[model samples]
Target: MVHHTMATSTTRASKASSKINPMNLRLLRFLSTALIVGTLVACSTTPLPPASPPPASSTPPAVGAVPGDTAPLPPPLAQAKSRWVPVRWAELPGFSTDALHEAWNAWVKGCERPAPAFAPLCGEVRRLSIASPEEQRAWMVSRMQPYRIESLDGNAEGLLTGYYEPLMDAARVPGNGFNVPLYRTPAGLGERKPWYTRQQIDTLPEAQAALQGRAIAWLRDPVDALVLHIQGSGRLRVTEPDGSQRLVRVAFAGTNDHPYQSVGRWLLDQGLVRDATWPGIKAWIAANPQRVNELLWSNPRYVFFREEPLDGLDAAFGPRGAQGVALTPGRSIAVDRQSIPYGTPVWLASAGPTAQLGRLVMAQDTGSAIVGAVRADYFTGWGPEAGDVAGRLKQGLRLWALWPRQP
Candidate 1:
């Protein structure tokens, strides 16, 4: 009952089986050729035709086959990789004895804080001694004027703070006096506070004569350049190690929510007042014109300025107003801060390499707009000049923040 039948070429349908299906084979060969041509096209690297000139154009990113690839891009701000070698003063084109001392002064001050094991090659500033008491007192008065000099040593939007006597290079050589306007804030405007009065200042004959003599010596010497500082309170741009860019926003000095620095406090530093009554002291200086030197001795902090913008401090961070955030230097190690809370220490190694690559620092500040997983704000230090510098610094940063417990 099981029968098997096998068809052969010569069987009943042999004629049909022997017929060649040339069309089917030809179709298969055509498809194979098509696939090979497509692969070759994918590997091709022919140049594109040039476009006609447009009316206006900015440089475009590199164009190729791939999409979403921003690599191989040139640095838009500074160079791809900037080389910052340690430059000896004598080796520089115009290094001088005075410059050396100034740099040294900066070095000394920086060393006073928690500095690296090895220090920058800068020097400390030396104060000039005034021989005559009258000259010293006069010099001190002019020195206290709030904003009266140009800073060749700092960037714009920066603040200035510290100790040094610089010439108020306006009109005549500073004698024993000078004055500047202190506008009433949140209360009135165009109101000027006359800091040094003539008669009351003359009461301290010993201190006055001493101050005058010290000033004269300073005037004789030619070390009267102003220091420009960058106060942290705004956008900052810095370069990265891998030829990339980063933007770091920094913050203000002082503990947050503190009152503005008063000139009377400076007076206390100079030993001008036994007890501080800023209004009374100012009134007394006004009443005593000839005694201005004693009044000058009471003044605190040196004055600095550039010829643009209202005091950047008031505009950026007066009361609720904010020029930028507040921070401790080198505290933010990474760019992202949500994980790294304010007051955490960080080392910015990936963005900017340093002498201490993995050094620990404190994070004493925060920024309003400092969002994302990789962003940071560096807090530059005190005064108006520093704020100017802080405003201008922007970069794409790769940083690392240190935990307080870790550091």
Candidate 2:
């Protein structure tokens, strides 16, 4: 999602625009605060699996070491560039200490549309509902085996980045201060593999004609809109034509088919900014307002979105991910579908520049950039605080997929 200053509007056009009223500004602050604290933490129950046999020996395993348990191991599933090596649950860092109850929500969501291998386990998973963290941990130990994921070249370490659902102010119709358009997918999008480039979408008559009357919302900043495109989904504080305001979500519908090109990389290549973060990009844009469009057009990829209602419980959850489950704020991850199947429970351990994270996360989503066996995009949830964490979260990472033990 796009990142920008949450302060009052300072642009001359925005100041002159009637849309930037006190009510709107108040709503923006309220939304920002809501986004930060909207993440719900609740306790629920699921069914537990039948008990398994005790370990071969009564002795506890060494810390960070996998014990030689006599549990049966399943044959490894082949992937394009990764292999899974079976390991005991004791090998997972912080596995016993993590708040598994927190992650249970995401796991239960995954069960709604489970992977083929995981389908049979879903009923038991639900039975474990309302289980304590320790109970959940013990149940997992009895029912699942942790598989260390390694790349083809034998590397267990890989990169981890973060992403979130951004929140922005928008208008249902073009007027007042909102002028930039966020479009739905154009007709005949399937006709072209790589659709019109960003520059062409803004300049070509045919492209413009195709998108006419398709604007889902209008924003004050085109750069913010670009961020929404990159993030693939966002929450909009939309002012309707009837002057009513409501919170709604615009999820990824389709892309232009062109490969994603990072505008931050463009800035780095141009040597205009050493730090290509969202703040840095915004600073660059502030200083070079005349060339903001040039910076945006540098990337060819364009994304489209579909509007979703944000009412009742829907407001508390995020868009459904690749696993077809509504993503849990701190427990959902996007991985290489080839390396780790959607709906799998994963143990993530990372220590790097941004933060240290060791937790149980579900592989519920995927991204274009999230390639390779060890690569993943950690979903940080919605709001600016989440965005801040996501923007700075490139780190050294290791992962273990926890799958059911074979009989």
Cα lDDT tens digits, model 1, 264-359, are: 444456665554442344455666667654444332222212121212222221111121221222222112234344332233321111111212
Please give each candidate's TM-score.
Answer: 0.21, 0.83
lDDT of each: 0.24, 0.73
Position 28, candidate 1: lDDT: 48
What's the true lDDT of residue 7 in model 1? Answer: 9
**Which candidate number has the best lDDT?**
2
TM-score of 2: 0.83
* lDDT (tens digit, per residue) of candidate 2 on 1-407: 22121111110000112233222344455556666886322111111112234233211122564334447666665567799888767767677566666677688889999999899999988766566656677678888888889997777888777777878889999989899999999989999878899999999999999999999999999998887877778889898889877888898888888877788878878888887777777898999999998998987888888898886556656678877788877788888888999999999877654555668899998877778999778777777767767776665678888877877
- Give one clash count per candidate, in the order shown: 93, 14
Off by over 4 Å in 2: 1-77
Q: At residue 29, what lDDT does model 2 achieve?
A: 57
**Model 1: lowest-lDDT 10 consecutive positions:** 4-13
When summed lDDT is taken over every stretch of 10 residues in candidate 2, the lowest stretch is: 7-16
